[model samples]
Target: MNPASRLAQISFTAGPAALLAGWFLLRPIHGEAEPGPWWTAGHLAWLAGFAMFGLMIFAMRGLAGPVRGGRRAAVEAATVVALLGVAANLAQLAIALHAGFTASDGEQMRALLSQARAYPGIELVVYTPGAQLFFFAVLAMAAVLALLRRVTTVSAGVTAAGVVLLGVATLQEGAGTALAAVGMAVMWLGTLLLGRGPSGDGLPATTPTRA
Candidate 1:
C-alpha cells in the first residue's frame, strides 16, 4: 500500500495496543490512590493511545471510501464524534498525568483528583458521556462499513463487542483493568483483520473509489 494507507493501518493497530499496555501498567495500582512512576507511565501510554485513535478516525473515513449525500455525511459525522471523544480522553489523561506529577501521596492524589472533578462539567464531559462518544462512534463506523460491504460482519461485531467490554471496564476497579486489557486485545484483533485489505480478507475485494 501507499505511505498514508500504511500509516493508517499502523495507527489502527497501535492505538488499542497502547491502550492495553496502559491498562496492564495501571492494573497493579488500580485501587491505589497514590500517583507515582507507574501512574505517570500508564497515563502517558493512554495519552498516546487516544492521540493515535484521533488519527485512526480519519483513517476509518478513508476506509469508508468515496460517498455522496447521506453516506458521506454519516461517515463525516462519526469522524467528528470520534475525534471529540478522543479529545476528551486526552484531556482526562492529561489531568491524570498532571496529578501524577504534582501529588506526593495517596491522600494528595485523591485530593487533587477530587478537586479536578469538582470543576463543573468535568465529570460528565471528560469522565463519562464525552469520552464514551469515542466508543459509540467507532461501533457506528464499523456497522456502517459492514453495511457498505467494506468490511466483514465478523469484524464489525468483534469491534462492537470489544468497545462494549472496554466501556464496562471503565466502571469497575480491581478487575476493570484486566477487562480493559482484554477489550483492547479484542479491538486490536478486529482492526488487524480489518486491515487485511479487500479480497475476502477484511476489506472489500476491489479498491474503493476515493472521494
Candidate 2:
C-alpha cells in the first residue's frame, strides 16, 4: 500500500458519505409522501450514480497526480458542478422552509410556490443545495467501489462511474434528493474501504498502476 492510495481512498469516502447522509436524513423536504428508511435506502441507491461522479475527477487527478491531464480537467469540471449542487440544495431548503412544505396545498402555500416557480431561471440561478444533495446521496456506492477496485484491474470502470455521477449533476435539474442518496452509499462503502486498508497509516494498494 502507498500514501497516495490512502489519501485517494479517504478523499473519495469523505466526499460521498457526507453527501448521502445529509440527503436521506432530510427527505421530507422533497415533498415525498413517505420518507421512511426503506424509501431513503432505495433513494440512496438511485443517487449513488451521481455521488460516484467525483471519482472521475479524482481518478484523473490520481492517474495524473502532480501533472494536469484529463483528471485535472475533470476535477475542475466536477468542482463547478459540485458547487452548483451545493447551491441548489441550500436554496431549495430556504424556499421550502420559508414557504413551509406543510402548507403547500393551501392558497397561501400555493402563492409562495407560484412566486418561486414563476421564474424558473431565478430558482436555477440562485440554486438550492437540496437539488444536488439528492443526486450526491447515492454516489457513495461508486466511491467505495472505486476504493475496493484500487488493487484490481477494474479501477478504470469504477473511476468512470464517478465521472458519470458528476456528469448528471451538471446536466440535470437541481435534483438534491438524488445526490443525497448516492452520497450515503459512498460514505458507508468508503468507510469500509478505509477499514479494509492497512491501518491509520495504511496505504490502499501495493503499487499504483496506469488504467
lDDT of each: 0.80, 0.45
Once superposed on the true structure, which residue ranges of model 2 sit more than 4 Å away at CA? 1-65, 101-107, 126-211
lDDT (10s digit) by residue, model 2, range 32-104 = 4232443344344434433443443344233333324543354455455554564555455455455544453
Off by over 4 Å in 1: 172-175, 200-211
Winner by TM-score: 1
Over 1-211, each residue of candidate 1 has an lDDT whose tens digit, in order, gives 6786667778878898888888778777773656888888888888998888887888778878877777788899999999989999999888888888899888898899989989999999998889889999999988887777677788788888888887778767432466767888998887766665444443333454434
RMSD of each: 2.6, 8.6
Indicate the TM-score of model 1: 0.89
Q: Of the candidates shown, which would achieve the greatest lDDT relative to the real structure?
A: 1
